[model samples]
Target: MSKEICFIADSSGGLPREILERHQIKEVPFYFKFQNTDYYCENVDYTGSEFYRHMEKNPEDVPQTAAPNVNDWLGALEERYVRGAKNFIVTTISSRLSSSFQTASLAKDVFAEQHDDVQVEVIDSNTCACGQASLEIAIAQMIESGKAFREIVDRVNQAVGSVTTLFVVNNLKYMEAGGRIGGATAFLGKLAQIKPVCEFIDGAVRPVKAVIGRKNSLKTMMDLAISRVSDWSRLIVTVQNAEFSEDADYAVDYLRKAASYSGKIYRSDLGVVVGAHSGPGAAGIGLVEASPLLR
Candidate 1:
């Protein structure tokens, strides 16, 4: 008999609430605090729009994210384990960016004795925000289609490599404030009206290049990302993040021109978890190749 399977991921997955519920996946929250009141990432208590607005009103008040604690995982997992899940797959943000992977892994070890049948597969998505969320959704689809545990894992691993994320920041102020860029680079970028193009390469967030203006930066990001893929016509999905109306529109208009994609394009907030790192006024595009099973 096949084992009963369930999907799990951290809040960094950044999936829309409805999609997450539709897939019946569980997400452990990452912590974020505002005005001395703490809230879990993705919790309705705090919305991306609200957080972004707060940042706008108080540019100096940069929020930080905390990894889920052992108890956070334990409490969440215990309820699910009781529901008869025999095997589990939990994916999280890059270890280089956060410690959620380690926390989840340790929690699995701690609960092994009581839930021996539960196999927790902790995946380091190696990308944050919607990029990580996109991977989780892909894996969830694989599981729901009745792929075996090992098969699903192998497919997810392959998908991870296939996944590529490229984004451009409207300004370097927030990143500079968060120390993502050096003082000199930040200063020069501000003076020159330079927009930074960033990508998750080799499991690390690095600035690939900078452009003189937003329009040029968008074109360059699209060109570079499209160049990496052999068949833009085969692209199946595109996800975007936007804080300002113009930034969102710019992403949509530019991405449409860059690739010949055939599948549905979805939009999601950058979310607080990712926003905490990427900051507001960030726009990005991620494309997932057509699944062999679907084809």
Candidate 2:
């Protein structure tokens, strides 16, 4: 691990444990209130998919996820700072989806107030899950190559603009309840039995199109994601799902047969906080054109 810099992200990214350990990435936990009585910390008490599975039994739960406060972010940064890392790169979920970005920025401000000789750069990745993980991995590579902190920060922001997350939403009710979509829009989509394709654009989830069925929606998402790829020579494709691993596997197979990518394919789950808004049965293809410091 580089003692000069540290990389941190909220747990909503659902980054694999191996990657987190290998990259020395620190994850700040997000919280969710279960049954209006119990509080569960995401990735600590349960995962993204696990949340949906529990919801299956209840069937009437509305998600109430909370972002880590300034203190939580401060504590995470302080831990790394105490370990001799003067530079911190904090990545948060889209500012639109959650207030994590703003909270993390506040924490950075607090760190700056106390420490005169440290750098903290927080990025609103405008994405979550696989998309966020891609950005984290790329920054880790940059750190390992001994890149300057400023260069890595610039690269991180540039990479955020390159994130394309095309998702298949099985139901729109969850989005509507979470304020991601309007009631009329969700009503109309469900009324027609339409499987919607949503895109994470400019830190907001917007409807892209309507596909015929769930299977077709999965194919359409993958097709759209691959079609938009500027180049495959430096690309990372991730297929992630919320309680739908079989569909994720199918999407991966389709990606393999469709085109050749130099970078690897990641299989991941949407995090609990994100999954609550996206809802169960949501699957997505995260396509990131690489900005790497070391191959």
Candidate 3:
């Protein structure tokens, strides 16, 4: 008998609505606390833009994010299993960044024990936002190409190491409030107009380079990312902005003129999970090379 595979991701994966609907990808949402009230990350009650607008007005009370509990993961998996899926491949934000990966793994174990016929595999993307989305999209393509389950799992695991997540914040106040950065660093960065180009290294966010302005920061990130690609034609790129469509548009234009990458460029909102910390006006580029060209 042939096996049916289902793809699942957490809210931090930053997948757009169309991709979610088209691929039939299931999601578990993360929760955030705003002014003592709890709000789910992708809930309709509070949209991404609305979350950012609230944060902008209430700068003192930046929202706090919470990873989905094991029950949440199990619920999503159970629903898919009831719908005739025999195999599940779950991807989540970096384990180092959140407990979602661990929760998903635990849920898989429990669910598999209850249904001996089902198989569940959890992957720690080791990246977030579009980086995670890119990996999920690649796996969906593999599924469409008729790859075996074992081969798909191995390829997805290997692809995690090749994915790159990079971004620049317009203001560091949100980061500082979230305790991701020191207040002194935020203050100094603001004073110097230093927009630091950051990337995920070893599953942690780290500053790679600093530029004087937002435009330069975006360009630097794109140039550095493009320089690492081995095959431009196979490149998968995602451009995202935090309540800043103009900046996202600018990045898309820059990618066309600068990298000359002809592949489809996935564009999405940064989403509230990342947006809460990145703040408004932030923009980023995520690149996943079809094959790694460098160390």
Candidate 4:
């Protein structure tokens, strides 16, 4: 008998509508709050570019984001289950970065209790935005290829270690407001025009290097990403931007010239959830090895 697997991810994944519709993937939106007004990330009311436009006008008002409600996850799971999905593979942003993973896990438990015949697995992507999206895409493909649940889970776990995410923000103020950097550090960095290159370390975003300009910051980020990949021929890259399409385009061009990857390079918006904290002019690259390295 064939298994019906349902794929779900949070809005933080930054997956495009085509992928969602094509793969039948369900997304739970995160909540964005600006000046006491709440906006849903998945809703049509606010888009990533619109959110950045609002921020440009109210530079002082920092937007905040909240994970999807537990009920949202439960609803998604139950709805799909009722539609004849016997297995569920849910992916979310890093557990260290947000509570969505915990929320999804809880929802999975509740869903399993109500439907004892179903199997639900919640994957902590250990990264956000394009990183999560890449994993979701890979998982969906595996499921379509008739991979078993245990095999799919193992592949995802291996992909976690093989993926590398790097990004740079134009303004440190957003990072400071989000508590990713200290006020003093943000102040000093701004004074010196220092741009920090951030990377995911053990599921948490951390500033790994600092450069003098945006140009250098992008170069540093790309270099750091390239250094980690043992073989560029087996690489899948995702370039994400927060209202910085020009820069993202340039980065993609540069990556094409610099790397030897034979896989597809996905371009995506940073999404409102991460864009709220990264602010405008933020660009990132997520690299995933197509084949897992032997341990």
Structural similarity to truth (TM-score) of each candidate? 0.90, 0.94, 0.94, 0.94
CA lDDT of every candidate: 0.73, 0.82, 0.82, 0.82
Clashing pairs in 2: none
- What is candidate 2's lDDT per residue for 156-203, written digit by digit as tens? 776788788788878878888888778887788787788888888888
Clash totals, every prediction = 0, 0, 0, 0
Distance from true location, Cα of 266 in model 4, Å: 0.6
Which candidate has the top score in TM-score?
A: 3
Residues forming the 10-long window of minimal summed lDDT in candidate 4? 286-295
Over 4 Å off, model 3: 1-3, 291-295
What's the candidate order when arranged by decreasing TM-score?
Answer: 3, 4, 2, 1
User: What TM-score quantifies how close candidate 4 is to the native fold?
Assistant: 0.94
Global lDDT of model 1: 0.73
lDDT of 2: 0.82
Q: Which digits, one per residue and each the tens of the lDDT, describe model 1 over residues 1-295? A: 1237777788875676776778888878788876566664656567778878887787777787789887877777787788887688888888888899899888888877677667777788878775676676667677777778888776777677667788888767777767788889989998999998899876677898889998888778877777777655445444556466576676666656656444556667776766776667777766566454223
Over all chains combined, what TM-score does candidate 2 have? Answer: 0.94
